[model samples]
Structure formats: C-alpha cells, structure tokens
Target chain A: MLIELQGIVKDYRLGLEIVHALNGIDIRIDQNEYVAIMGPSGSGKSTLMNLIGCLDTPTEGTYFLNGSNVSHMDDDQLAEIRNREIGFVFQNFNLLPRASALHNVELPLIYNGTPASQRRDLAEEALIKVGLKDRMGHRPNELSGGQRQRVAVARALVNKPSIILADEPTGNLDTRTGDEIMDLFEDLHDGGNTIILVTHEEYIAEHSDRIIRLRDGRVERDESN
Target chain B: MQFRESVFIALDVIRNHKMRSFLTLLGVIIGVMSIIGMQSLIEGFQKNIRHQMEQLGASVFQVQKFPVQFGQQDREKYRNRKDLTWDHARVIEQYCTAVAQVGPEAWQWGIMAKYRDRRTGPANHLAGGVPAFFPNNGYFIEAGRALSDTDIQHNRQVAVIGQDILEKLFPYENPIGEHIIVDGRRYQVIGTLEKSGSAFGESQDNRIVIPLSTFLKFYGQNRSLNITVLAASPELMDTAIEQVIGVLRAVRKVPPGEPNDFEIFSSESLIETFDNMTRAVRIGAIVIVSFALLVAGIGIMNIMLVSIRERKREIGIRMAIGARRRDILFQFLVEAVFLSEIGGILGILAGVGIGQLVALVSPVPASIPVFTIVLGFVFCSLVGLVFGVYPAAKASGLDPIESLRYE
Candidate 1:
C-alpha cells in the first residue's frame, strides 16, 4: 500500500455554525493504482483531495503515505513532503504566466535544491515525455488549453514523485482536448506511475482502474473498474 | 528556494513594473544624495582649514592681548589691557627655556603698493617681522633674500614682497632691488616670496614683509604685536607655553595669584572650535535626511504590500510547488533591497556631482571618499530590510489554499 487514510474527518466554522466538510472516511490505495474520486458539487471531494495532497491536515484522522504518518506534520514538513513525494496538477493548469515552459517544468527541481546543470536535463526529459520538447520555450499564454495542461503535467513529473494528484485535469478543455489529456494519463499509468484523480464525470471515472464515489461528505461506493 | 532564483524573480518584477519601482526608489535617492553631498563639502572645508594650520607650523602657538573675535563687547574688554609688544616677545625669548624662537609680527591690512607706473589696490597686507618669521611660518623666498637681522636693528626701509605684490607691482621685471611705494613711503624690495596658494578663497600671498623697526616707524608704535613661538619639539609645547606665560606675567608686573590677561591659541584649539561649530550642523542635516529616508522606506513598504496582494495567486502556486514560508519572505526581501540599492547607487553619483558643483562655485571644498559611497549603500539597504520585513512576513504567512483560490 502506498497510501492509507483511516477515519478521516474535517470541520469548518461558518460564523455561528460548525460545518462538517468531510465525515468519517477510510481508503486504501496500492502502488501504481489509477484511482478517480467522483463527486458532485458540495460533496466534500475537494476537502478530501486537499487532505490527500498533504495541503491540509485532517482534524481527526491518521494518514499514512508510503508508511509514514503525515496527518500531524507542520507546514514546512508538509512542504518538504510535497516537494519530494507529491506532484499536483490543477484544473486551471496553474502555470506561471510569465515563465517559459522549460522554466515552469524546472520549478519542482529548484524547490528541491537540485543543481542547476542537472535540473535542465531532468526538465527537458519531462517536457519531451509530455511531447513539449519543441514548445518548451513558449509561455503559458502562447500555448493552447491542452498544451498548457501538458506543460503542467511535465512540471508535475519532473520531480519523479510517488504519486500524481490531478484535480479536474480536463475541466477547462473541450471534449477533443479532454480525451487527448485522458489518453496521456492512460499512457502515464501504463508506464507504471501511480495516479489519483478527482472528477465529477462518469466517463472519466470509467477510464480509471478503480472508482470511489462520495456523497454528503461520506464515501457512497468504492469498486474496482 | 535558492537565493539566485529569488534574485531572478525580483529582477523580473522590477522589470515588469518600471514606473512603480522608480517611484518607490525616489526617496532613498534623495536622502542618500544629500548625505554624500553634505559630507563631501564638510570634508573639503575641514581639509582647507587643516592645510592652512599646517602652513602655520604644527608646533607653533600665538600669544596676543585678546582672543580672536568680532564682538564689540569683547573689543571693549581688551581695550584697557596693555598691548603685547616686541619687548614682551624679547622678554619671553630670553627667559623661557622651552621656547626655540619667538617672532613678533605687526600687521596693517589693506595697504597699497606701487612700483614704477603700476600700482595695486588697497588689498595688500603689510607685515613686520624678523628673519625667523619666513621659515617659522612656512614662507620661502622665491627670488632674493628675506629680511635680515641688520635690517631690523638699523630700521632699514627694505621689504620682501609676496608673489601677489610682485605680480601686481612689477609684473614684467624682477622685483629684487626695486623701490616700491607702500602707503606713500618708498621701501627697497629685497626679495620676492614663492607662491603659496589660497585657502577658503582668501589669497595667502597678497602681502609684503618689512622690518619691525621700520613697521613701527611707518604704522606707529601704538599697534599691538602678536608673538609666534615655536617649541623645541612637539612634546615640549605645553612646557614652552607655560614658560612664556610665566615670563610675560613677571615682565608685565602682574600680581601673584591673578589671572593672566593674555590669550594663547594653537592650531589644535582652532580645529576643535571648527569641529564644534560643524558638529551641530552635521547633526541637523542627518536628522532631516533621515526623515526623508524614512519617507522613502514607507513608500517601499506600501508598494511591497500592493505587490504581495497583486501576486497572491502566484504566491499560492509557488507554495503548492514546494516553496516554504522563508522562501517567499526571502524573495520579497531581496526585491525591496534591490530597489533601495539601485536608488543608493544613483544617489552617490548625484551627490558627488552636486558636491563638485558647489566646490566650483563657492568657497566650500568637496572630497568624496570611498567610505561615504559605501555608507550610502549600506544605510539605504538597511532601510529596505527594516521596512520590507512587515510586508514579506505578511506574504509568507498567507494560507496557501486561500492564496491559490484568490481571484
């Protein structure tokens, strides 16, 4: 098992009321497994994704990532975990607008204190893996929706992290570009990379090796595809 | 993140907002400029005073009936005292064991000199002293000899003209052995002095030297005399001064346990007085300039806050990619420091230019040492750091999830 979540719970305060963003939940994901978390709006999927990404600590739960307890880690310790272990791809692409594609891919390596000489080679290889070798010098604004997402994907892979966590990776693209991105993720999964995705589309869930559905801040169903 | 990456990010932001960066840097620029400019002028003034004092001989002191002053009340206080005279100088030289030599000088300012068909205006100084006056006061003969002991003993009407007098009275010919009319009386010019440049815009070589006897005859015996005494060595200066005071008290018949009426001044005292006067002005200038820098620092803080707010989403993205809190802080701090340093460098250049301009047009001398430039840079950068901390901390303390969601 690469990730294990036990009895996770998250709470929020809204003025005079306490809201439960995530109710009790348990999950286990094995190495190289492709999983998609499905939910509608206000179904706690975002909160769960935030927890899995090590971005937020659970109020009452224990999270074991690669056999290390991470739910109680501090901000800097979590940042180190994020740098060395997790790669995130956002729905909006989250590419630095002014940076060239190559520089964007090199961001994760820079944060990890990689030497400048080696960072170039690793970033270039990641770009080439995502079919962005020729367009590495272009800025995000100059690239199309799919190309920008590919650049973001390359940035995520440059660190060779344990798992790739992409939140609504195809939310901003048309159907054609969306299918292309899903095909790219399929290719990455076939290459033996662990991938966890969050989405609301049933068709997207069908492509994953396993599916977990959330409703009212609790898991409604979990099944292998 | 690495320091180099932080610098690169800072440079990128500055390049993106050219006008904003310039506006933020203006205060630092003006503050540093004034500091360097004022320092240069003050240094120049002190140097000029030190040079004049050096010319007057480092180990010498002056004794007169009254202190150097301009107030009417001071003049009235010294009016009843007996004038310092050549006889008093003689008494000190004879009795003071620590004294090396004593030279008595009597001065008449604004005297005119005429040679042949040419004449100078009433801007000349007519001084009467013995042979030791030339060497003791750092004046050297450029042409002929100086006043001799025989000239003073016999009261000869011979003079050694300064370079200004020589140039004005005998521009095309040698002044030695010529007869010059000074204040309607003819005196034989025995020599011409080498040129000694001006200080504080006052020409040093605009005078003629004549014998004490001849000066007494021409300018009257009622004039007070100032005695210049050189010590045997610098270490014996205090002893020499005390011995001269003792001899003067006995010769003038002053009663025991009474205060001496004469005032003795040395180059050290004069320099101390100059420093005291300039110190107050220096403090005032620094206080005023610091307020300007304060305003500049505030301006930098304001802009940095705006920059942080504007780039909230960017900060979130960086944090999501593994940028720690200190990394964010370091990046913003570097940006602010870079802005201030740029302003400081420009200020140094402008300050040196302004200092040189003032020197050219006025009496103040200007010198820009390397220390002032370094000080300007260091001070402004400190200002940047101090003011930058608050904004950088604010940026670094933001919640990563919130910042990423900022519109």
Candidate 2:
C-alpha cells in the first residue's frame, strides 16, 4: 500500500460555526494505481486531494503515506515531503506567468536543493518528456494553453515524485486539448507512475483505472474499473 | 531556499515595477538626506565654535562684575559697580603663586576716538591694561611698542591702537608715532595691533588701549575693572582659580566659606554653557524629524503587505512546486531590505550634497561626521527589518491550497 487513510476527519470553523468539511474517511491505494476522485461542488473531494498531497494535515484520525505517519509531521517536514515526493498539476496550469518554461520546470529541483548542473539536466529532460524541448525559454503568457499545461506537466514530473496529484487538470481546456492531457497522463501511468486526479466530469473519471465517488464529505462508492 | 534564488525573485520584482520601486524609495531618500544634512551642519558648527574657543588661550580666565553683554547696555548701570576694584586685581597677582599673570582692564564708557579730526567713536571705546596684557589676553602688536610701567606711573598718555582704531585714526598714515584723540584727550600712539580677528568669539581688534592710570584719572573708580589671570598650564587652571580665590579672600578679608561675590569664567565653562543650550534645540529637531521617518517606515510596511496580498496565488504555486515556507519568507524579506538599503544609500548621498552646500554658505566650514553616514544606512536597514516582518510572515504563513484557489 502506498497510501492509507483511517477514518480521517477534517472540521472547519467559519466565523463561530463548525462546518464539517470531511467526516470520517477511509481509503487505500497501492503503487501505480490510477484513481479519480469525483464529486459535486463542496463535496470535500478537493480537501481530500490536498490532504493526500500533504498540503494540509487532517483535523483527526491518521493518514499513512509509504508507512510514515503523514498527520504527525510539522510544516517544514510536510513541505519537504511535498517538494520531493508529491507533484501537483492545477487546472490553470499554475505556471509562474513571468517565468520561462525551463525555469518553471526547474522549480521542483530548485526546492529539492539539487545542484545547478543536475538541475539543468533534469529540468531539460522533463521538458523533453512533455514535448516542449524547443519552448523552454518561452514564458507561460507567450505559450498556448496546451503548451502551458505541458510545461506544468514537465514541472510536475521533474522531481520524479512517488505520486502525481492533479486537481481539475483539464478543467480550463477545450475537449481536444483535454484529450491530449488525458493521453499524457495515460502514458505516465503506463510508465509505472501512480496518478490521482480530482475532477467533476464523469467522462474524465471513466478513463481512470479506478473511480472513488464522494458525496456530502463522505466516500459514497469505491470501485475498480 | 538558496540566497541566490531569493535574490533572483527580488531582482525580478524590482525590474517588473521599476517606477513603483523608485517612487517608494523617494521618501527614504529625502528622509536620510535631511538627517545627515542637518547633522553635518551641526557638526561643522561644533568644530568652528570649538576652534574659536581654543583661540581664547589655554590658561586665561576673566573676572567681570556682570556678564559681558554682546548688545548695547545703559552707561549709567555699567558705571554703578562699586565692588570690583583694581586693588583686588593687583593683590591677586602679587600674592597668588599659581597665577602666572593677572591683568586688569578699565575702559571709557562711550568715547569716540579719532585722529587728524577724522573722528571715529560713539562706536569705539578706550581700554587700559598692563603689558603682559598683549599675549595673555590674545593680542599682538603690529608696530611700535606696548605700554611700559613708566607710562602708567608718570601718566605719560601713551596708547596702543587696535586694527579698527588704527584704520579709523590714521587711515593711510603710519600710526606708530601719531597722536589720536580719545575723549578729547591727546595720547601718543606708541603701538598698533595686528588684525587679531575674532578672538574669544568677539571682534577684539576694534578697541583702543591706554594706560590704566590715565583711564582711572579720567573715568574714576566707578567702572568695574576686569581682571584676567593666566595659569601656568591648562591642567592647573582649576587649582590656580582656587588659589586666586584664597588670595582674594585674604585681600578682601571675607569670612571663610562665604561665596565670593565675583564670578570667574574660562573658555571651557563658557562653551559648556553654550552647548547645554543647543542640546535642547538639537533634541527638538531630532523629535520632529523622527516623525517623518516613522511615516516613511509605515509606507514601506503598507506597500509590502499589499504586494504580498497580490501575490498570494504566486506564493501558493511556488510552495506547491517545491518552495518551503522559509523560502517564501526569505524572498520577500530580502526584497524589502534591498528596497530600504537602496533608499538609504541614495538618501545619504543626498544628505552629503546638502551638507556641502550649507558649509559653503555658512559662516564656518562644514566638518561631516563619519558616524552619521554609517548610522543612516544602518537605521534604514533596521526600519526595513522591523517593518518588513509582518508581511514576510504573511507570505510564508499562507495556506497553499486556499492560496491557489484564491482569485
């Protein structure tokens, strides 16, 4: 098992009121699993994704990532885990708008304290993986949305994290562009990388190897394709 | 984060908003400029005043009945002093071994001295003193000879003319043997003084000197005689003054432990009193200027917070991509310090320019203090750090997920 959650509960205080964002969640995933977390607005699916990526800690219960207790780590330790073990891709691509594609791809390696010479080599190889070897010097603003997402994917894979966590990764693209992104993720999965995605569209969820449906901050159904 | 990466972020931000950075730095520039400029002018004033005080001589102290008024005073009140006598001055010189020389001076109240009917007085006064008078009291003869004991005892009516008196009385003629009329009394001009300039912080080269006996005969014992004593060395000046007081006590037969009715003053004491007065003024100026600096610091803090707020999504992306919380904090902090340091450097340079300008226009030359230069930059950096803390913390403390979701 690569990730395990034992009845994790997350509560939010919204100005004098307790709003339960995630109530008692239990789930498990093994290596190379392609899982899609599907839900409506306010379903707490995004919250679960954030927890899985270690961007946040659970308010209660325990989460185990690679047999290490994820819920007990301090912010710096969590940050270190996120930098070297988890890669994130967002709907907006979230590439530094002013940064060249090469620098954007170099972000993960830079935070991992990689030496400059190795940083350049790995960042270039990652960009080549996304088919953007020639667009390395172009800033996000100068690139097409598809090109920007490719740059973001390169950035996500640069550190070769244990799992790739993407939130609404294709929500901003056209159908054809979204298909291209899905095809890229399919290739990453075939290469033995575990990928977890959060999305609202069933068509996007249908393409994953496994589907985890969430409703009202609880897991409604978990099934393997 | 590596310092190299943090600096890159700072440099990019500065380059992206060049106009805003310059505008923000303007307040700092003016603030530093004013502080350094004012301090330099004050520093220059201190040096100039100190030099003038030193020219008053190392060992001389003067005794006067009342404070020496720089402005005009009523002649009636000045002539009413009956306590200070020439007898006291002579006895002090005769009995006090610590006193190297004691000279007494008495001057005509309002005499217009003249030569060849080109009259010059109403503005001029006639003073009389002993011969050790010249050097001990900060005077030097330009030509001819000073007064001798023969002139005082026989009332020979010999005179020594100062620079102004020499100019007024003789004009183009040699004043050594000339006779100048003082208060309608004819006296042979035996000596002319070199331009002694402003000694004891006053123009001393503008008065006339005659024999003390000649002065007493004309003006009587009504005017207070000013007694000046020179100690053997500057270190012993205090001891010399105590010894003079003892002699004066015995000479006047005053009761022991009784406060002397006369006052003694030296260049050091006079300067201390002057500095005390200006200290209050300098403190007040500093207080007023601090208010401007406070406003400038607030401007820096407020803008930094605004910058951090606008860059929330950028910060989240950086963190998600791999930047640690400290990396985010370091980047913002370095940016703020860089802004303030640049401002401080420019301000200090501006201040030096203003200081030089003031020095050129002022009565004295400017002597800038090095401590102010170092202090100005250090103070500005401190301002950056103190004010930069909250915003940098805000940048670091941001929740990555929510920050990414923020519109």
Candidate 3:
C-alpha cells in the first residue's frame, strides 16, 4: 500500500464546543490507484482529504505513506513531505495567475532546490506531459479554463511525487472540460501514479477505481470499482 | 537560484504596482535626503573655515605677554613676569639662526592726535612696530616707506598712516610730508599704507604704524613685546619653531625637560585646535544621521508588512507550487533593499547639491567628505536588509493552505 490510514480521528474546537470532523476513518490505497473521496456538504470528506494530503495532522491513529508514519511528522517535516511526496490540485485551478505555464510548473523544482538550467528543462518537460507545450508562455489569464486546469495538473505532476491529492479539481469546469481532466487523471493512473481526488458528484466518483463516501463525520461506504 | 528568482520576482511585484511601491518608499526617500543634504551643508562650512584660517600666514606665529590661551592658574602665575622688552627681542635676533625675522609691535589705547587746531583728537588705534613687520605678517608698504631700523634706533618721531587715516586726517593736504600731533608730540608722517581690506570681518586699513623706538619713548619699556617670526618656507617651519623655543628657553632658563614656561601660538596650531574642538559636533551629526536611518528602516518594515498582507494569497500559491519559506522571504527583502538603495542614491546627490548651495550662498566653502558619502550608501543598504527581515520572515512562515484561503 502506498497510502494507509487506520482509525484516523480529527476534531475542531468551535469556541466552547468540540466538533468532530473525522471519526474512525480506515483506508488503504496502492500505487496506480485512482480513488475519489465523495460525500455531501458537511460530511468529513474534505477533512479526510486534508489529512491524506498532509495539510493537517490526524487527532488519533496513524497514517503511513510509503511505510513512513506521516501522522508523526512535525510542521516542517509535513511541508517537506508535501513538497517531495504529495502533489495537490485545488478546485479553483490554483495556478499562479501571473506566472507562465512553464514557470508555474517549475515551482516544485524551485522548492526542491533544483538549479535554474534543470528547473527550466524539467518544467518544460512537465508542460509537454500536460499537452501545454505551445501554451508554455501564456499566463493563466491568457489561457482557457481547460488550459488553466491543464497548467495546474502540470504543476502537480512536475515534482514526480508518490501521490497526487486533488480536491474538486473539476468543480469549476464544464462537462467536456471535466471529462478531459478525468481522462488526464486516468492517464496518470495508467502511468502507475497513486491519485486521490475529493468531490461530491456521483459521475466524478464513478470514473475512479475506488470510491470512499463519507457522511456526518463517518465513512459510510468504502467500495472498489 | 534563490537570489535570481527573488530578484526577478521582486522586480515583477514592484513593476506590477508602481504607485504603491513609490508611495511605500517615500518615507525612506525623505529620511535619506535630510541626512545627506544637511550633512553637506555642515561639511561645507567646516571646509571654508579651515581654508580661511590656513591663509592667515604659513610660517607666522603670534606671541603675547599673558598666553593667548592658558589655564587660569598658569595665567595668574606668569602674570608678573617682567614684560618682554626690546633687549630680549635683540637677544633672540642675535641667537636664533633658523628665524628669518622677528618684528615686535605695540598698541596705544585710546589716544588723541591733532592737526593744526583741527583736533584729530585721538584715533582709535596707533600701532608701533619695526620695518620687518611688513613682510613677517604678509603686509607690503604702499607709500613712501616703512620705518627703518635706524629710525627705531634714533627714536625718530615719524609714522605710517593707514588709508582710513589718510582719508580722515589729511584729506585736504599731502599727509606724507605733514606733521601731526601724536600723543602730545609732533610727528612727521613718513608713509601711507595701501588699503588692506580685512579678510575676516574687522577693518585692517584704519591703523597707524610707527617705529618701535619712536613708540618706546612715548609708551616705553612697561609693555610686553608682541612679535611675529617668518620661516624660510613651510618645510623650515618646525626647525624655526624649535630654534625660537630653544632661544626663549635659554633666555628664560627653563629647566631641562620641563615644559616651556613661555607660550607660542602658530596658525597651524590654531587651525588644529579649532578642528579638534568640533569633534563633539561631528559625533552629534553622526548620531542624528543614524537615527534618521533607523526611522527609515522602520518605515521599510512597516510598508513591507503591509505589502505582504496585501499579497497573502499570492504568497500561498507560490509556497504551494514549491517556493521554500526562505524563497518568499528573500523575494520581499530584495524588493525592500531595491527601494531603499534608490532613495539612498537620490539622497546623496541631493546632499552634495545642498552642500554646494550652502557654499554658494554663505561664506563657508562646501567640502564634501568622500568617506561620509560612501558610508551613507553602506548604511542605507544595511538598513534596508535589516528592516526587511522581519516582514520577509513573516511572509515566509505563512501556512500555504491558510494563506491560499485568506480573502
């Protein structure tokens, strides 16, 4: 298993009340897995996604990434892990609006301390992988919505991390563009990448190899397609 | 990589919001300008004063009975030393080899002179000195002739009138051949001096110069001898001074290694003393310039923090993409340093210009200290780097997710 979370629990303190955001979540994901975590609004799905991506630490239990106990990591270690092992894709197509597509893809290598020559080369390669070779110089504002998401995907894939964690990656895209983004995810899964996505749409989850549905701070179903 | 990217990023950020960036750096500009401009003006005054003092005479030194400057006790203790007499000056002339000339002069206070019942009632000044007085003090005789050594030996009652006296006392007559009543004695006017306008504020052309012997009978051996010595050249100054000191020490018989009992004042020494005394003012100026720099640093920090707040989401996106905390920090810091350096450069130019203006309008000459300008640049750059650190660190420390979600 590339990712394993056992008995994970998370709680938030809302002033005087302790609100349980995630409870007894147990899951395993292997390399080449295409998984979507789906739930209605207010379910613990986004909270679980946050934990899986190392954006937050679990309140209880252990999360092992490639056999490393991620739950034990400190803030700096978590950030390091996020940079080296986990790639994140966000709903708003969170590409830096001012940066060129190629430059946007070069960000991970920048944090990775890659020298300039290699950064340019690898960022270009990543842009090519996302079929944005001709749009490398165009900024996000100059690109189409689908082209912007492609740049975001290029950014996620540039570091060659062990897992890609995306939350609502197509929430702002049209059906045609959404299908194209799903196809890219499918392509990345076939290329032996561990892909975890969070969404609320049944059709989006149906395209995944596995779907984990959450309801009211609890995992309601864990099914493999 | 960090440096290059940060520079490019900073430049982009600054360019993207030109107005905001200039406004943010305005405090730094004003602060730097004040320090540079005012310092230049002060430096100009000091320079002009130094030059004016230097021109008094290269080799000349002044001698007075009570030291021109001395401790209260020293003045009192030496107060009774028999006034320097003509014989002592003659002894110095016979002994010191390095001295080129020693002209002793005397001052007559509050006296009245009369010319043919048109009472020129005491001129305010009637000075008595030997002929060597002209060259020793860089003065030249403009009329008939200066008082000769023979005139002093015979005590002949002849006088050299300054131009102002010529205008006032002998406007209707040829003053050189005329006789004037000076201190209850009739004296022939031997010469008239050229108008020597005072380089400083006082008038130089108003005095009457007569021979020491002529002055002695009327004023006599009661007064101290005031002498000026001329050295052959600037190189011979120290040798001449040492020779004079040795002659004085032998005459006074000052004990072997004991400090000289008599005082000597040279133009160089005077210049040195004046410069040394202004040390406190220089220190105060430095402290003030540093304080302005500090305030400028604080201003950079404040403005940078505001910029970070305004760009929180942008920072978060950069971080998420792979920007290390330090990368973000460096980017902001580079921007700050750039802003301040621009201001510092402008300030230095303004400062030099201000100094020039002061020199042009005031009596003082503008002297720009090269060291101060160089130091100002280094200090300004350092201030930018230091003050930008905290804000840069704060930006670097932001959590990516939280920053991204910030509205």
TM-score of each model's chain B = 0.88, 0.79, 0.72
After superposing candidate 2 on the true structure, give the runs of residues whose Cα lies further than 4 Å from its correct spot.
Answer: A13-26, A32-34, A96-144, A174-192, A201-211, A218-225, B1-34, B67-85, B106-129, B141-222, B250-255, B286-296, B322-343
Q: What docking grade applies to model 3?
A: acceptable
The sequence of per-residue lDDT tens digits that candidate 1 reaches over residues A62-143 is 9999899999999998888888888899999998898999999999898889999999999999999999889999999999
What TM-score would every model get versus the actual structure? 0.91, 0.79, 0.74
Best by lDDT: 1
Clashing pairs in 1: none
lDDT of 2 at A143: 95
Clash number for each model: 0, 1, 4
Q: In candidate 3, how many Å is residue B93 off? A: 4.7
Q: Is candidate 1 or candidate 3 better by TM-score?
A: 1
lDDT of 2 by residue, B1-407 (tens): 57777778777887898888878777788888888887787777677667766877879998877654433565455444446788888888887778888888886655787787798757666788888677677778889998888888887788998887777778798888788787778899999887866532345677788888888887786667888899988888999899887887777677888667566778887777667766787777667656766777788888889888888999999888767888888888888887888889999988988889876765445667689889888888887887788899999999988898888
> Model 1, A127: alpha-carbon shift in Å?
1.4
Please give the TM-score that candidate 3 achieves against the real structure. Answer: 0.74
Chain B of candidate 1 vs. true chain B, TM: 0.88
> Ranking under TM-score, best-scoring first?
1, 2, 3
Residues A106-200 of candidate 2: C-alpha lDDT, one tens digit per residue:
88888888998999999999999989989999999999999999999999999998899989889999999999999999999999999999999
The TM-score leader among the candidates is 1
